[model samples]
Target: MLTDPSPTRIDEATIRALPKAEVHVHLEGTFALADILFLAKENGEYLPGPAATLFDITTHDAFAAPAVSTGGGAGAGAAGLSGFLRFLDWQCGLVRTPAQAARVAYAFAARQSASGVRYSDVIVNPTHWNAWRGREIALMRALSAGFDEAEQDGLCAVGIAYSLLRSQSAASAVDAVATLASARPGHVVAISVDGDEKVTGRTGEKFHEAFRLARATGFRRTVHAGESSGPDGVWDALDLLFAERIDHGVRAVEDPALLARLAADGISLGVCPRSNLTLGIYRSWDEHPLPRLLAAGVEVTLNTDDPAPLGSCLEADWAVTAEQFGFDEATMIGFAARSIEASFADDDRKAALRSELAAVVDERSRTGALSS
Candidate 1:
């Protein structure tokens, strides 16, 4: 039944209840169409599409909002990833004040809480928030203030990781890092470079100094690579930026050497299968290398890269990947445990989260609710 094209038989509710951490999600792209409509109307931005059509649009079909009609790109469907990206740019442009940024953070945490994600390290690239470009520190504070409120309400504990757009100039990268490093924002935990590596070409050298400065300042490092580029991009992130984790490093399987190094070094990959499938990274789930990577001992933790527009959720990721790969309950738990261990959260928080995961598993095991 493993690797069968048929949908997984695992209990999705069980997966939804598991204590988990989401590490690779992007705040800019996390908004639902409903959220998009709400945020747009609130800020008085032009409606992206007709209200009736947009409200009826599901996340799975959101990518098809005509690019030419929206902002003009490749076309529709997968071409609409660009369309969606433009959608994000438009939505993100609506945040003109710190209060708006805080609201975005609080809403993001609440959404994650509904999915049972106890903690999250969300990627927030200032470049996406064109309105807040010059005032990054204030932006960070506003987001943190929002997250702090959510946490107080017993929602997921959220940490911000500034994702440097890959296409930004090296000087721009350094300046961003310098500003963040100087402020040392408590809520912002890591520094990451995310964008189209295929389009931006190699950026390891471009971000080396910035990452070095970040590392020296005790900020964690993660990089978006191996998704758009090949194994070489992963290597550049590892060697150049000293990234502790590589987002979408699925392509590492292409190089035996790189794959071996990743495992031996215990580098984690925050793999987002739905994102990959939506973007046509693999033609089908059967073609995905997630199973192979797990077998190869990669510390792979599942995530929904762009949850809203991609129509993704963490529980579905766990259930589907478990059934598709024939993973046992222990394997699913291992992935969840690794997500906590791999987090940029402090040692005490990590321990608490790990305890929470263990407690949930034990309770489920006793109640006979677990699938396997």
Candidate 2:
């Protein structure tokens, strides 16, 4: 029997206890302060100050400063989204060997598991790995080994989405898609594009051939759009790349026709509320378009785009969205279902997860334990 997807008051504890899947997390953005400090020590690198100082600028108050783009894309400088990208690049640069990459990958999956994530489709943009760009196959294998360790430990099942940076050359994007295509299929499930949409201006036309190659090679597609840009970016991602899902597509709220198309086509939007606020995309949670998107029948799923940099996590994102949107236990469960439905996890894994989620919801419903 299908449970009603109506609002029913739930609490933070209930939200945390629910099994979930995170599809928009970045491997480059999962580094903790301690991890950074440790990595710096291991690499014999110097820090300007304490590790905490590196992340202090991500606070809401700090975001009041105008963001400056360094023209090379988000990874170009240390301010705003560009600063976050620089941080990501610095973190990626810290891993100088396949072994180090494996360690980071394992730690990422382990962290997500602690947050109650049963499955994660973590994105790793090869363009950021200046050290390992030409050696992506080795990097993927190392990361896969680490993910294999986590899966064997019964922590969380993991998959990679080989991401392309819009700032990178078209040749590099094509090479990335080709690399992922030739990689072990179990390690990579999708090809995605991410970076400052503002820098690239949502011109999906730039990578049309690459995406066509990805589709022809049998890889699923997702694209980052509608975050810094507008609804047109999301449309380009759909109309040009034929993306199976969208990352940070909340700007679709600005276009009714786009919203209708999303609903009609059943496309999923990986929405990140805290990332939006921290990035100054929206002023507040109430001002976010998640509620509006859900009301329009869009399949919206919550995610933590970059947990450490944004100082948010999957559970926290869910809790904040629930509180802001007045989502009840039922609606919360519906979000979980939507995530599972939208994920690139194989049908068998999806079936198992859906069953587990349904069982949990039913149990909570019977025990009336959804409230604090």
Candidate 3:
């Protein structure tokens, strides 16, 4: 009766209840069309299309005529790259205020809670907001408040990692890091370089100085590398940026030496299955390098790079990774363990999380929820 004999079938309900951590989520990236509409309406920004039609407009051509038609992009049935870019542009519309930022952060944590995420490290890019109003302090305050609220609500413990836009000058990054290093949100977990990886490949040297300074100050470091280009980008991030973690490190599989290096260095990778599929990073889920990375003992954790826009959820990621990439329950448990190991949490907390995770797995095992 089975189409093919496989160790893992990844039934929907099983994946739904899987306890895991989401390490690479973007706070702005969680914006839903409805949230977008609400934020835009509140901020008095005009939307490119109706709330009902934004997803449809997501597929419009990059160079497509703007405002020339009511029915935009591809329809709601499917989305294209143009549609995603449009969504990105629309994202810039909602995140203009501290209050809005807090609301989005709370909402994001709530959604992750609903999707069964036990812990999350949400990436917040303050660059665009600074460009809008120059109130980075207010933004940080709002973020901290949201994080506290999420924790109080029993959703999960949330932490903030600043994503310094690589497009900004190295000096700008220094200022941002200094703000994070000196602020009330002094426990800012990590300093990450994000935004066009192509540009990162070109200017990583300029940012390395700032990254080094941040590392010296006890700020964790990560970079968006090896996703958009060759192993050189990975090399730049590791050798130059001295990244503590690498996001979207699928390309590391191509070079065995790099894979060995990553494993030896114990640098974690924030892998997003659905994000990669939606962005055409892989032709299909099975073709994804997640399994190979894990097999090679590379430290990797699953995440939804962006939840709403990519139509991905934490449960969905678990399900797809298990179903597509051939992970059994043991493999899934190992994946969760790997996340704990790779997490920025302190030693005591990491031990606690791992202990709790083992308890969950044992309970699931006794209940026959997890199979071989």
Candidate 4:
């Protein structure tokens, strides 16, 4: 017999111990303040504030205010998505060599490992790495080297998702897809599009050709939509880009038809609740649409879109989701299973992960740990 999905239970420790998959994290957004300081010092760059002070400000005030311009092109204070992107651009500029890229990747995996993330699909936009302007292949190789090292250490298995910026021209998007298809980095598995959806308006038609080409080349697709835009953006992503998964697609709750379609098609939404809150997408966790989406039968998975920047982790995300939504152990475990199913990992890996999760759940159940 199965436990009730809606039972009133809170198990923070068990939630932390659950093996999960994070499919929406960004490589550009995972750099710690220490990492940033080290990179800046190594490259003779300057930052707005002391490393500790800056980290404290960004993490604590992330949702209090929009990121303010520091007059140095990078954002300061608790910046929103646009400001964060500028800071991310500046950070990416510091990584001038493949070795630097590898280090970043390795550190990101190490962090995820500490949070019990067994697998990760990390998104990286090549356009952000201005330092490696014409050396995209070298950059990919460097990132792959880092992830390979992390895997060897039993940290986590990672796959790269090459992301297209919505602000870029169609030609640039096509070029990126072509580069990804040609390079075919061992760790590269999917193509994604991310940017200021409010500025770009979630217009998927702009990159239809690029996404189509990516699909033809055997790459899976995901799109960032419904975070800043609306259900229309999510619709455009499905209709135009043929996205297999949607990132931050909570706005689908507003459209009954869209919810029905998603449930019928079994499409998964990689939701980042804290990201939505910090970005001003919702006033509070109580106001979030996740509960409604779940009730509507939509497959939902929790994630940290930009963990370091938002001061969030996969474990924390799940814990908060349970606390806020009153999710029981069974419901929480279902989210974990959904994450694995929605991932682009191979069937063998997915099967193994599922079995591992099942064993954990069984052990916890037999020991009565989940009910505690």
lDDT of each: 0.79, 0.78, 0.71, 0.81
Best by lDDT: 4
Residue ranges of candidate 1 with Cα displaced over 4 Å:
1-8, 52-76
Off by over 4 Å in 2: 1-9, 57-66, 69-78
lDDT of 1 by residue, 7-95 (tens): 34665676767788888888986766776667777877777457655422323344345422211111123344454565567678888
Q: What is the descending TM-score order? A: 1, 4, 2, 3
Better of 1 and 3 by TM-score: 1
Clashing pairs in 2: 8-328
lDDT of 4 by residue, 192-212 (tens): 998777766656999999999
Query: In model 3, where do residues sit more than 4 Å from their true spots?
Result: 1-8, 56-86, 130-132, 184-187
Question: Which 10 consecutive residues of model 2 have the lowest summed lDDT?
Answer: 69-78
Question: Against the hidden true structure, what lDDT does model 2 obtain?
Answer: 0.78
Q: Which lDDT tens digits does candidate 2 get at residues 318-347? A: 876776666676778888888888888899
Candidate 1 is scored at a TM of 0.91
lDDT string for model 3 (1-372, tens) is 112335657665665465667778777677777788887788787766555655555434442333321111111224443344455655655677667766777887788778766677777777545434467767777777777787788876677788887668989888877877777473368888776564334667989888988888888877877665667778888998889888888888999999999999998898887777666666676677877887798899887777775566777777767776556777777777877676676777778787888788889889887787
What TM-score, over all chains together, does every model reach?
0.91, 0.91, 0.87, 0.91
Candidate 4 TM-score, true structure as reference: 0.91
